[model samples]
Target: MIGKLGATTVAILLSGSVMAAAAERVEVFSTSGCGCCIGWIRHLEEAGFEVTNENLAMADLYAKKTGAGLKPGQTSCHTGFVGGYVVEGHVPATQVKRLLAEKPDAVGITVPDMPAGSPGMGESDEPYEVLLVARDGSTSVFARYPLAEDASR
Candidate 1:
């Protein structure tokens, strides 16, 4: 009986740690004129993230601060900072959650050239790739999602 109680305690502690780690807050920087950015913010909030939205004229500055880069023609509507990770464009909340959970050795994530169904685009049924952007401005494919994959779906 004592052994069983000890095991239960350990399991409870492990579950608490996982829940605490997953309940991280996110900060999003976006232009006020972009409606899609707002939609993305909503997406994050719905995904159990405490999101704070900041409308700024110099989003590039925020991007640089968070170690996110913008490639010409690949730039999207907004940028986000979550768990020391940078997220660009309309990346899905699930991918962001995965990044935080995995804690990759890169700077952050990006989805260049915003797709229609990405988070915040208001169309959550499009396939897209979240690219892992490194500090040196190099990037690679991080995660892929099909259309209809959203925070709720």
Candidate 2:
């Protein structure tokens, strides 16, 4: 009975961790004139993220992205911080949740260049990749999109 109880408790804790990640608080920095950034924030909110949007001037927003260690090629209109990870550009909320759950040993993930089919940009036949940025600024393909199913949406 004690062993069964222990197992159940562990399962509960694991499930709770996933729930926490899904509902994590995200802080976003973007320019006041960016409608796309607002759309991205709405995407996060709809996905259960607690979003705090801080609209800065373009210069200040650029500084925040640079300070977060995002290179020119890795940048987008908005930047987000969550669970100590820097989320750049139009990264989907599912990838953000996965990052929090996996707790990778890196900076964060980025969509880069604002792909047309990305969450904020709406649907398209064009595909895009989400890159996981390392501490040294190198990136790897973390996720790819415009799958057969996704392209329809």
How does each model score on TM-score?
0.74, 0.83
Model 2 lDDT-worst window of ten = 144-153
lDDT of 2 by residue, 1-153 (tens): 558779889889889988776559999998887888888999988888899999899999999988988888999999999989999999988889889989999999999988897888976768889999999999999989866644322
Least well predicted 10-residue stretch by lDDT in candidate 1 = 65-74
- In candidate 1, list every pair of residues with a backbone clash: 40-120, 125-147, 125-148, 126-147
In order, the Cα lDDT scores of the candidates are 0.75, 0.87
Off by over 4 Å in 1: 1-23, 59-74, 124-126, 147-153
Quote the lDDT for 21 in model 2.
Answer: 66
Error of 2 at 66 (Å): 1.3
Tens digit per residue, CA lDDT, model 1, 1-153: 558779889889889988775557888787777888888888878888888887877756455544455555445667778787777888878888889889988778888766877776654556778888776777788877773444452
Give candidate 1's whole-model lDDT.
0.75
